[model samples]
Target: MTDLNTLLQSPIRWMSQATDPDMRHFLRDLQANILKGHGRHFTGNIFVSFEGMGAQAVARLLRDLSGYVTSALQQLCTARSSAGPGFDGGPVRCLLLGAGAYRALGNLATMPGDAAFQAGMRARQVALADPPAEEWGEGAWRPGNPAPDAMILLANSSFEAVTRDLEAAEGWLNGSGARVLGVERGRAQFRTFRPGGPAEGVEHFGYVDGRSQPLFLAEDLKREAAAYAEEPAPAGADTGFDPAFPPSQFILADPNARTELGAGSYFVFRKLEQRVRAFKRREEALAEALGLTGTKAARAGAMAVGRFEDGTPVVLSDNATEAAPPNNFSYANDPEGMRCPFQAHIRKTNPRGESTPKLPPEAPAERSHIMARRGIPFGDGVRDFEADAGQEPEGEVGLLFMAYMASIEGQFEFTQQVWANNPRFLRGLAPGEVPTGIDPVIGQGGDEAARTQLWPAGEGKPMVPFSFADFVRMQGGEYFFAPSRSFLREVGL
Candidate 1:
């Protein structure tokens, strides 16, 4: 196994743009240089559970697992070394332990700092903070299920690489410490509505997914600024960012941290099953009701998703062909939600300027309530939503939703509960305006009848209403902590 402490303490000669241009020029003159790895696309996921395992056995498992940790530095080097067209940066792996697993070790008393990990993923506090019962489907989530003991994440440039890693992991874990209770493999699929239409890469809904993500930075000052930037600036514009901060939010400091545990991140794992057929039929029905047809019928879907199937934000331009950066648009200009309905999936989750009015005047700059989402699709690639609209789904398929954060309650949970699931979110509406509905895509409606969503046709048009059947069903999930390299070693030792 890799020496966790030594790995953590090793000098990482990372290079980047210098804060002082003069100092950078001096370094260039002296032939000094530095480089760092950008992030990698781990397109595969495998979640494992170790149940009924003893403390000693769990420790041994972690020791073995340490051998699989892939550092960011390695990723950079791999990318640099690639020479051929098919050459790749190789796979990266991560190991995370769930709250139940930690409690089973009987070490919460020794490591009181891991209170959040001990709380488990489905704890009442976590559930309440992330979408209440009224927002979830009937008995879909929060069914008093036991959480997983651990999760194994493997990311590679290709599916074959991931499969090979999965096989190796299964070999490594065979009776190593904990017996495997379950294994969920995550894979990515691509398809387009037309030949060469809207890059083949799309979620089951036929819209480009995972387009908007928070920036990842390493500095405290940058993170502080980003946390404030989640809400719009005073002039109702993006708080123009300083070049100092990386355009990412992964830099948030984790509170109640134990240094010995190394730099760790909290993870929220969910197995979501998408009802593609149901969603398509509903969209078609809604489009027909709204008198939307042909290319314009696409608007009905865009109103719900806040973007067309081609990833163009309707708030920015009506034509999906007008390719633009999807994340560049904000909600400030469309306060009345004429361009983007307040209930649109993108609008509800990250309201941007819309969040400012909801903040208490005395509160700290409203933190963006950000989470670094890293999830991939799972199940067989099914694109029958268009052809098999009225029929039952051919097979199971959907997103294996996963997110990394410093605080489950603050980031991931808040986005889900306070934003996505909140019907009354994006405050400061006129007295007579109706309250915004739940996110049409992922928002759970307690009962079938309550699943209504609002879809605006265009400016000066009445908000069109469409009821949704639970299209995305939550199967199971858990909360886990991915400890730093050193922390894993300490636990094993």
Candidate 2:
């Protein structure tokens, strides 16, 4: 029979195929943060979509995941159905996993070689012991579990089956009360990776999504373990790490050096709302300031966001020049806030050039606190909303921003508090250039519209970029330590 090692090695061996430079640091940092503590008390969270199949199949899949529950994990959260009875026009047929459920899933990672999985793996990736779904095959997956509190980005597959298959997964995520979590779409998809910048948002601007992802850490961990198991780490084991803090290490319940229930990653979840129409209205109105009339204004709007409302980045220049691809430019290159404006939404959140000196352009991957973004678009898409619906978003569209960081202060917090909200962005300003402004996107705001402070707005930005007093509001969230696969089996539920 194909042993657990071989099955596990499949994805791990091919790890390099799933990652890029930007993503490695993100996951490593995730490793550090999760290892910092057991994260006993669950807190942060965010859920994602999965491609769907059919009902009888999906409904059966959902039942298998929720078959059992534990006590410790249950106190944290509960999982169930989104739609009322079954998966008809159900709330998209989902599986809401709770902290308790996640903990149970983690244990599956350390599945023993001689365990039932031995026969199971030999049978197929997906195993259906009973009439219901059972194998961890292309159709069936693992325990729908959670990994260590570190950044593994490990998954059985990447393609999510929301309309059909994910009904089981949705149960675990939405079911949990804690936060600090998200699911990624991958081949042999499993929840072994760390999600950042809205924790793997579904769509960037207007793409089908599951497209843009990190550049760091490999995708398959089984392959990595097998490859590096024999080879020694380079001379400076901590080669690319920081001198002041170095990298973080985790201890698990293993023969090499066992520790019960120790060393796991975390899952952080956040439900962020996006004001599509409001954002558009503001952008459209602001375009007038540039004096770009009609077609010109349309271009101006696209440029302001570095992309068209359709999620097409302006940097692409219509695939003409690669000089500036979307999500890859410096706002200061055009200090007038002309090309990619000081108040552009993406620019504000990521603030590429705003913190130049602080960032090592030579090694964009060097920064310790920096993280990768995995935001998914939530709610309804852009649509005309009635004026009265401001309290309740018009179309119900929003971006779930999730980031995995070694240090929340530097990675997550800094990005949100300073870069995204801070006004006097990039140190000194050009003589004639106006002060930096608040990020038009996630930047906060208040009751009155005029009170809104953006570039070329009320009080020319200075100390605070935008004067959004009560704009983006937090709906629900939670944080939990995502343990490694081993920790789940030996010391956990």
Candidate 3:
């Protein structure tokens, strides 16, 4: 088993990983914003294709990247020395290789067993039922941008540090003459930041984001237990389920039992463009239709998102801020989907204590479904839906969604396919009842009719049949592997 110290510093292990040198290597985003309590200060993603690069050139480039890549120990020491007391911010960067990129360099027998990872992003669009060209922006979906072979990420606490790190990476990639690696750049490149300029925790949709994430690592679980002890629980909230996921749950074993890369995780990247104006407009309409006005109108949005904008889960709070958000809860008590709709975004994606009929009874529990979501919101601040009512906005915007998992097919893809996109998810039918709707926020129901959810109307009210306009569009994305430090030093180098 890989030592917890050797793992990455993802959201699941943020508490414990920060102190351990090996684990810190994985905490790519910690240096970005202090107020948000976690995540990168800013993240820059540069996608590249290796169309004509030969094996020798590709190998050389990987070696150069091995040298350029920042280690977590370096980040920790650098942060301590430069940031003064209590600040752990530093210019941190990571490099990942897509399957296309790996094939471009030279096919590897060490690649993961997951078919989804072996097949490129274009293949995934069809398998995942993502929207086709007509539904997506120009050059956004499949076949528009060529599948990228590699992605470089630069993260920092301040905009200047972010710029500095990106410049360094850009300079390395664009090295002149002998240093060049026969690189061919791709179109999908963007940086991420907190919406509304450096103020942390708010997503483009005005929701306090990143709540209810899973806890891993000993320290993370300990901290949560401490917080839960101090805080008042929502009536009947289950706080006893252990959040500590053993390494076997999320880490990949060395496929060859001798390779460094085997210790790494597969990364799933998707650029989801949120239709803010359209979503907000729908919320207003739904609110009015539900006889809710002003603040109550927000409940309509909450019903769709399964959480109030404040990051509180609907199952726990009537309003977004009724009680502070709680991390632990299960669907055992709310089987009928009364408090939280069966197809609500969070419920569909994680389904705590809820049995999924499509999945086997012996299948891993909800803990296995957890993702180390390192995603950051990109694009301009929240769109002025009211002001820009009819006209289109200037540039692209939404989440630069990225998740690190041992199995793309098992965790991230499973959540998307079996849970989120399936309208029949969490089924418990009574004669002639309508099926649950797809996840309104991220679920890509190809047809308009497939994009509907049965909204749980408050106590005694009849369940409202709510239809959803596809609000999130899949821009381009590819799967990549962030190799371990050992892998870089040995095979990648």
For each candidate, what TM-score against the reference?
0.77, 0.47, 0.81
Number of the top TM-score candidate: 3
lDDT of each: 0.59, 0.34, 0.62
What candidate 1 gets wrong by more than 4 Å, as runs, is 1-50, 108-117, 125-146, 191-200, 217-261, 322-326, 362-367, 382-395, 427-430, 447-450, 458-461
Off by over 4 Å in 3: 1-38, 75-88, 107-109, 133-145, 175-200, 238-242, 254-262, 356-359, 381-395, 428-433
* CA error at residue 14 for candidate 1, angstroms: 4.5
> What does the lDDT read for residue 359 in candidate 2?
53
RMSD of model 2, in Å?
17.0
Across 1-493, the per-residue lDDT of candidate 1 in tens digits comes to 2222332232222233235443232222110001121233334444445566777777777766766676444544465578467677677777777766666666621332435556765565445333443443322243332456777777777667777887888777775755454566666656454454454456667777765555433333354455555733324444332222122233222222234223456777777788777787778888887788887887777888888887777776665754333344566566677776777888877665557766779753435466667777777544544564467463377787887666676777677777776677663255875667667888764443335656666557786777754677776666777655544555645
Instruction: Name the 10 consecutive residues with the lowest summed lDDT in model 1.
Output: 26-35
The residue pairs in collision within model 3 are 8-26, 9-26, 9-27, 29-39, 29-40, 32-41, 101-149
Q: After superposition, how far is residue 308 of candidate 3 from its true place, in Å?
A: 1.0
RMSD of each: 7.8, 17.0, 5.7
How well does model 2 score by local distance difference test? 0.34
The better candidate by TM-score, 1 or 2, is 1
**What TM-score does candidate 2 reach?**
0.47
TM-score: which is higher, 1 or 3? 3
Mind giving the per-residue lDDT tens digits that candidate 3 earns over 314-334? 776667554456656665557
Q: For residue 303, give model 2's deviation from the true position in Å.
A: 4.9
